[model samples]
Target chain A: MLKITNLHANIEDKEILKGINLEINPGEVHAIMGPNGSGKSTLSSVIAGKEEYEMTEGEIIFEGGDLTELDPEERSHKGIFLSFQYPVEIPGVSVTNFMKASLNAHRKANGQEDMPANEMLKMIREKSELLEMDRKFLSRSLNQGFSGGEKKRNEIFQMAMLNPKLAILDETDSGLDIDALKIVANGVNKLKSKDNAVLVITHYQRLLDYIVPDFVHVMLDGKIVKSGTKELAYELEERGYDWIKQEQL
Target chain B: MELKDKLISSFLAFEEAFDVDSDIHEVRSNAIKEFESLGFPSKKEEDWKYTSLNTVLKHDYSVFPKKEDALEYRDIKKYLIHDIDTYKLVFIDGIYSSHLSETTHDKIDVCLMSSALSKSKYKPIIDAYFNKIVPKNGLNSLNTAFSKEGAFIHIHKNKLADKPIQIVNFSTGNESALMVQPRNLIVVDENSQAQIIERHQSLTDHPVFTNSVTEIFAGKRAIVDYYKIQNDRASASLIDNTFVEQQEESVCSMHTFSFGGKLTRNNLNFYQRGERCDSTMKGITIIEDKQHVDHNTLVHHIFPNCESHQDYKGIFDENSTGVFNGKVLVEKEAQKINAFQSNNNILLDDKATINSKPQLEIFADDVKCSHGCTIGQLDEESLFYLRARGIPLKEARALLMYAFANNVLESVRIPELKKRITSQIALKLGVSLGFDL
Candidate 1:
């Protein structure tokens, strides 16, 4: 469903993703494990079309189409969602209003009519219930003063609402506790289907314990050096990344 | 002739209609003398440092239009909050439009300033509060001298107005260039409450200059909410000077929404005479093109245990310029006072300019005073976050700006006015909010 071949990317002339090749098929959950500054987030940012990162040489094909020239909103309308590590705090815009605007924008891009208010509310209620969110939480300003777990859960809530084709969870497990992690993982697992895919980028395997991945990749120094199954995540957790770096050397 | 010289001659011609030996005439004489000494403020003055009147002053604006132009209510109904019940004091070319006005005198006095100045019953109030709180300034004196027709609102003790008051002044471009001065006086006695909305609109692209002064007195335990809607044409300019005084346990709030105009200068001041009074000054300015808007506010806490809050947000795009000067003062005897001031701005383009200054003078040893000023661009990361969620760039930027100005709009007590301002904000941002406020 998604393909990245030799994705060489840089931020301000400093190469972050040197050379990387990865692919994920439909219904496959791929977990990318790496240490800090290993280009895992860079790969996701480049896929989502962040403007700061320049693609010196690479090709990212999504659903048999090149995504290099599309703007971020265009990429979003094409069903690619990035659950940020740190969601921005947009004060005075409630979660419900933000989602409505977003969903209507998507519809407008697709030449579809605006979703009815009843259907919109119904969808919000269902998705928020899946993430175990309070009704009051949906009325608060988007991510403003939200706890880490709440923000992460809110991200998954948005994921559930949009139901993107390729979802990238960038460090979704960092600030989550055991309970929130289970809720988030369970939500992702429930949303998984044969026509969609998820790319999970995380440092630890605790989240992987709940949402098992079909393939696990170890990224070291801007390159994916090892590819294995879910067992590789456990092995990395048991033995630190240093052993992997040593092996790569 | 210069515009200043023309105004002096217009003042002489305007005074001929009234009795020259009356008490009101004496006040007008004193005000004109003050204006003659101080013709107009220049950039050299500290208070007018960032905003210059050179361009707006260059027009040979007629002090008074010779012909009284009439307008159909349907054409200008959108300018007023007509959806709600209000006592409207409407004007066309500085002349009172009685056909378009809804004045009342049964329980409260919601009528014209001309009648209030000439009538016998309102003379006591005119003598008491007229020009009482206004500090000596060229613009205020100029407006005071030419003050003939505006809104006059007075609420008695222990009485509540049946509805809100709306003062809307419209210029019809009858004169090649027109200049109007509107004076409003509001006195809410003890245990009374009132809501007022003021607006200045030019129907056409006539170079209209409006110099307006409003004096508001809030009595003990009175609640006063006032809003100013300034969205004039590109050829219009406005100088609004509002002075308010609060008694014991009074609550007074001012919300100024300046969206469009060639130039607008608002001087708003609040003085607390008794303890436990609260003053709120909130403003939102969104302007593009060559529009300029300035907000100058002061909150003086004289008695102990009073509080004041000032929050001003400005968004300047294109070559628009904005200025905010917020001042707060707490007297030595006013202990346990809390004064907070915040000015935040976003310059969309590189050429857009904003000059923000917060001046706090606290003489009380036990007062808490804090002020903060911020000038920055919209966060790119935040913008990306919104755009990534499928919201277009234009709508996303508008949403962010609306969010930035939303907190100030939250304090708007009038529901209709709040919704109107929200819609205006959306319109100014050139996007649809897609939902009700």
Candidate 2:
């Protein structure tokens, strides 16, 4: 579903991701675990086409097109989603209206008419129920005065509503408590299908326990040092990332 | 001739037309003398440092427009909040359009200022409140010198106005350049309530200058909401001076929305005369293409336990300019006063300019007074967040601006007016979604 060849990215003069290559097949979930400042978030941002991070020498092929040349909105229209680590607070835009605009924009980009108001409402009701979000939660200003767990859940709620082809969860589990983690994990699990993929980027093994990945890649510096199954997550969590740095050395 | 001299000379003709035996004649004569002394405020004055009336003062304006510049209601319906029923005091070319106006006298006086000044029945109310709170300023004096027209609303003691009063002034461009001075006196009696909306619109591209003065007296426990909508043609310029005096426990708020015009200046002042009085001044300014808007607001806390708030936001594009000068004064005896002032601006283009100054003078040590000012572009992260959700860059920028200007509209008591301001903001931002998001 996605391919990256030697993704070398930099922010300003400092290189963040030196040499990175990865591939994920359809219906697969891949987890990338790294310590702080190890370019884990940078890798996800590069994939999502954040403009500030300059992709110096690389090409990202997703759904038969070079993603590097496209803007973030174009990528969004092509079914690419990035659940932000910190969602922006828009004071006057209600969450339901935000979802409606996003859904309509996607439909318009695909040469389709706007979804009927009733159908949009029905989908919002069903998806919000799946995420255990109260109806009142959808009426508040988008992420304004929301708790940490509420923000993460709202991001996932957006992900569920957009239903993108490739979902990149960047540190989605960092701020969630045990209960919110389970709910978010459950939502992602229910949305997984044979035609879509997800890339889970995290700093701990706690989230992998809830949404088990098909493969685990341990990142050191900027490159992936080891690739294994779910047990690799437990090993790294128990022994810490020092072993990974030693292995790289 | 310069506009200043023309106005001074026209005062004689205006005085000759009115009755010299009337009690207001002395007031008018004194005002004209003051105007002659002060002339038009020069840019060198501290209060007029940022706003220059050079462009407006250079026009050769006709003091009196041609009589009965007829206008059909259908042609100018969109300029009004016509969806709701209101007591409308509409004027065309400085002459009251009786055919289009709905003045009332059953419970409250929502009628023309000319009749209120000439009629003997309303003489007492006029003598008590007329021009009492207004200061001796150049433009204010000029308005008072020619203050023969405008809206006069007087809500009796303990009486509620039947509906909102809308005062609309339209210039038909009958002359090359026409100037109008509208004087409004609103006295909400003790325990009474009222809402007022005033707008100045020009039908043609001919230059129009309006020097308006409004004096509002909120008696004990009265509540008054005043809104000013200045969405005129690019050839129009407006100088609005509104003075509000509040008694004990009264609430008075003024909201100014400046969407269009060449140069618009709002001098809104609030004087809290008694304890527990509240004053609020808020505005939103969005302009482009050499248009300018200036807001100079002052709130004086004279008594103990009073509060005042001032919030002004501006979004400037192209070569448009904006200025916000908010001043709050808490006197020594006014302990426990709470005063706040905030001015935020966004320069959409490189040439856009905004000068924001927040001045606070507090003699009461126990008072809580704060002021904040910020000038910047839209939040990049917020823009990218919307863009990443498949919204186009243009739409994203518009949405951010809409959100930026929406908070100031929250205190709008009238839902229909709120919607109107919301749609105006949307139109200014070039957003397709019409209603609130």
Candidate 3:
């Protein structure tokens, strides 16, 4: 479902992602665990077409289409989603309005008519209940004055609403409590299907305990250094990233 | 050079052509003398530093005659409130049109000040409050000396008005530059309460200039809520001056929204004279293209134990410019007075400009007063967050801009007026954010 070859990216002439090559198939879950400066977040941002990162070399292909050439909205219309580390707080727009705009934009790009308001409202209610979000939450401004856990859950709620083909969870577990982690993990698990893929990016194994990965890749200094089963996450948590660095050296 | 001489001679011609009443003639003569002494304020004047009155002074604009042309009411239906009936007062080209105005309430008295001045019952009220609140400055002097006609509204003592009062000012001319000055004096008697909505609109696409002055007096323990909506034509220029005074334990509040105009200036002054009185002032301006909107507010706390609060915000796009100046003063005996003021602005384009100054002068040390101002662009991180959620960049920008300006709009209490202002603001944002509304 996704492929990256020799991905070299920089921000303002400072190299962040040196050389990265990765591939993931449909129905597969891949976990990329790295320390603070390992370019983990940069990878997600570059793939999502953030304007800050300058792609110097290499290309990204999603579902047999060149993803590097698309704008952020085009990438989104092509079913690429990035759960931000810190979700933005848009002051005047209600969550329902934002969700409807996004859904309609995607639907229009996919040659489908706009969703009816009644059906959209019904779908939002069901999803809010599933995510344990209050109905009033949809009426308030988008993420304005929201708690950390609430923002994370709202991100997951939006993901459920959009139902993208490829989901990249970037540091989604950094601010979640135990209960929120479970709820988010449950939402992801419930949405899993044979035709979609999930890439969980984190530095700790705590989130892995809830949504286990089919393959685990340890990333250090902008390159994937090792690949193993889910047990590798537990091993890294026990021994820390230093053991991986020593092995690479 | 010819245009400048023509503009100056035009004012001189108006002085000789019009015949004023004996008592008002003296006032107009004095005002004309004052205006000539000050001439037109240039950039040299500290108060007019950022805004230049050169364009207005250089243009040879014509003054509306006493009975030159008839005016029609075309778009008056859109501003009517459904829930509450109101006494409608209409003014066209600065002249009150009684034929087009209607009033059903018995307690409320609505009449043209020119006509009311002739009546013995309203003479004292007009003499006491007319031109009393505005300072004897060049701008105010020009408005007083050249005003064609105005409205006079008086609420009886201890009367709680069940309906609001609406004042509609319209300007109509074809290809001819016309100047209209409509003055309004409102007095809510002791223990009375009322609401007023003042709307300024233009009928033709011709270049029109409107200089309006409204003075309000909230009597002892009375309450007044006032709103000023300026939706003039794109070719029109407006300079609106509003003065509000409060008596003992009375309350006065004003909300000014500027949506369309070539160049708009709103001067708002609130004076808390009586003890234990309070006042609130809020304003919002949305500018695009070469439009310039300047808002100047002053709140004076003369008596003891009075309070005031002010908040103004502006959103500028294209090559537009906005200016905000807020001043709060606490007198010597005004101890325990609490006043706060803030001015914030957002610039959406690289060339858009904003100049904000929040001034506070306190003679009483025990008073609690604070003032601040901020000018900035949209948050980049917030923009990225919205884009990541599948929202296009343009839509994301519109959402953030709407949120930033919503704080001022939420303070408007009247539902119909609030909705109108909100929709107008939304339309401007849609254009600035590169979205088709």
Candidate 4:
């Protein structure tokens, strides 16, 4: 579903992602684990087309299209999703309204008319229930004064609503309690199907236990040096990333 | 002749039509003299530093309309809050349109100032409250000199108004360049409550300048909510002077919504006369093109245990300019006063400008006064967050701006008025979100 070839990226003059390559097939969950400053988040942002990160050299082909030239919203219209690590606090727009605007924009970009209001409400109710979100929570301002758990759940709720072809869960496990982790993982699992793909990026292996991945990749110094299966995540969790660094040296 | 000299010459003809022997005649003569002495405030003055009236004042304005112009009720129907019942005092070219007005005298007096000033029955009310609170300034005196027709509202002691009062002034643009001065007087007796909405609109594209003055007295424990909606044509300009006095435990709140015009300057002042008085001032200004709006407000705490709040937000696009000067004063005798002020502005275009200054003069040791001001672009992180969620950049920017200005709009008590302002804000932002307000 997605392919990256020697992705060379940088923020300003400093190099961040150097010579990285990865591939994920349909319906397969891929996990990318790395230590701090190992370019795990940078890779996800590059895929999502964050403008601040300049790609010096690379090609990202997603679903038979080159995503290198498209902007973030264009990429989103082409079925790319990035769950942000820090959700923005929009003080006046309620979550339901935000979702509606996002959904309509996507539809417009695809040359489709606006979805019916009743259908939109029904989908919101279904997805919000899937994430165990309170009905009242959808009426409050978007992510304004929301707890850590609520923000993470809201991200998954949006992912469920959009149903993107390729979803990049960037640090979705951070700042969430155990119960929230299970709920988010369960929502992701329910949305998984043969037509979509999931790429989980995390620094810890606790999330891997809930949403087990088909493949595990260890990134060090902006390159994925190790690729294995579910057992690899357990091993790394027990031995730590220092062993991988020493082995690479 | 210059516009100032023509106004001086026109004062005589303006006086011959009114009751010259009444008690307000001396007040008018004194005010005309004051206006002659002060002329017009120049840019040299600290308060007028950012907003210059040179361009608007150069027009050879007919001080009064040639004749009372007739307007079809359907043509101007959109300007009124038609969904709800209201006490309307409508004017066309400075003349009260009896056919368009809905005045009452059963429980409260929602009538015209010309009646209150000339009629013997209302003379007592006019004597006790007319021209009592307005400052002796050039523009205010200009309005007082020509204060013949406007809305006059009076609520007796402990009498709550059954409906909101709407004071709307429409200039039909019959003359090439016309100027009108309207004077409004509102008195809420002790323990009474009232809500008022005022608007000034120019129907055509001809040059129209409105110099309006309003005086309000909130008696002990009374409550008053006053709203001013200034959305006029590009050739129109307005200078609004409103003064409010609050007695013991009274509450007075004013909301000014400025959307369109060539130039608009609001000088709103509040004086707390007794203890436990509450004063609130809020405004939202959204203007584009070469439009300009200036809000200068003052709140004076004279007695102990008073509180005041001021929140003003502005969004300027294209070459528009805005100014907010908020002043709060706590006198020596006014102990335990709590005053808060906030002014936030966003410049959508690089050429747009805003001048915000918060002035606090405190002579009391036991007072809590704080002020905050922010002038910047919409946050980049928030923009990216929205855009990444599939919202286009333009829509994202508009949504963020609407959110930024929503706090001030939330205080508008009337839902229909709030919806009107909300839709106006949305139109200004140039985006139609698929959600109700």
RMSD of 3: 2.9
After TM-score superposition, the amount by which residue B10's alpha carbon in candidate 2 deviates from its true location, in angstroms, is: 1.4
TM-scores of the models, in the order given: 0.98, 0.99, 0.93, 0.98
Write model 2 residue lDDT over A51-131, tens digit each, in one string.
Answer: 889988988999988999898889999999999998999888899988888888888899998888889889999999989
Q: Between the candidate structures 3 and 4, which one is better when assessed by TM-score?
A: 4
Give the range of the ten consecutive residues with the poorest summed lDDT in model 2 chain B: B428-437
Better of 2 and 3 by TM-score: 2
Clash counts for the predictions, in order: 0, 0, 0, 0
Q: Candidate 1 on B1-437: residue-level lDDT in tens?
A: 98888888788889999988778898898898999999899999999999999999999888878888879899899999989999999999999999999999988999988999998999899999988999998999888888888889999999998898999999999898998999999999999999999999999997999999999999999999999999989999999999999999999999999999999999999999999999999999999999999999999999999999999999999999999999998889999999999999999999999999899888889989999999999888998899889888898899889888889999999998898998888888888655554
lDDT of 2 by residue, B1-437 (tens): 77788888888888999999888999999999998898898789988898898988888899988677889999889999999999999999899999999999888889989999999999899888898989998888889889999999999999999788999999999898999999999999999999999999999999999999999999999999999999889999999999999999999999999999999999999999999999999999999999999999999999998889888989999999999989998899999998989999999999999999889888888989999999999988888788788887888898888888878999999999998988888887877642245
Whichever of 1 and 4 has more DockQ, that candidate is 1
Model 1 has a DockQ score of 0.77
List ranges where model 4 is wrong by over 4 Å: none
Q: Can you rank all candidates by TM-score, best first?
A: 2, 1, 4, 3
Off by over 4 Å in 1: B433-437
- What is the C-alpha local distance difference test score of each model? 0.92, 0.91, 0.81, 0.93
Model 4: how far residue B331 lies from native, Å: 0.9
Q: Tens digit of lDDT per residue, candidate 4, span B1-437?
A: 88889998999988988778888898888889999999989999999999999999999999978899889889888998888999899999999999999999977899999999999999899989999999887999888988898999999998999988999999998999999999999999999999999999999999999999999999999999999998889999999999999999999999999999999999999999999999999999999999999999999999999999999999999999999999998899999999999999999899999999999999999999999999999998788788888988888898998889888888889888899888888877778776665
Report the error of model 1 at residue B302, Å.
1.7
Residue B330 C-alpha lDDT in model 2 = 87
Model 2 residue B137 distance off true place after TM-score fit, in angstroms = 1.5
Superior candidate under lDDT, 2 versus 4: 4
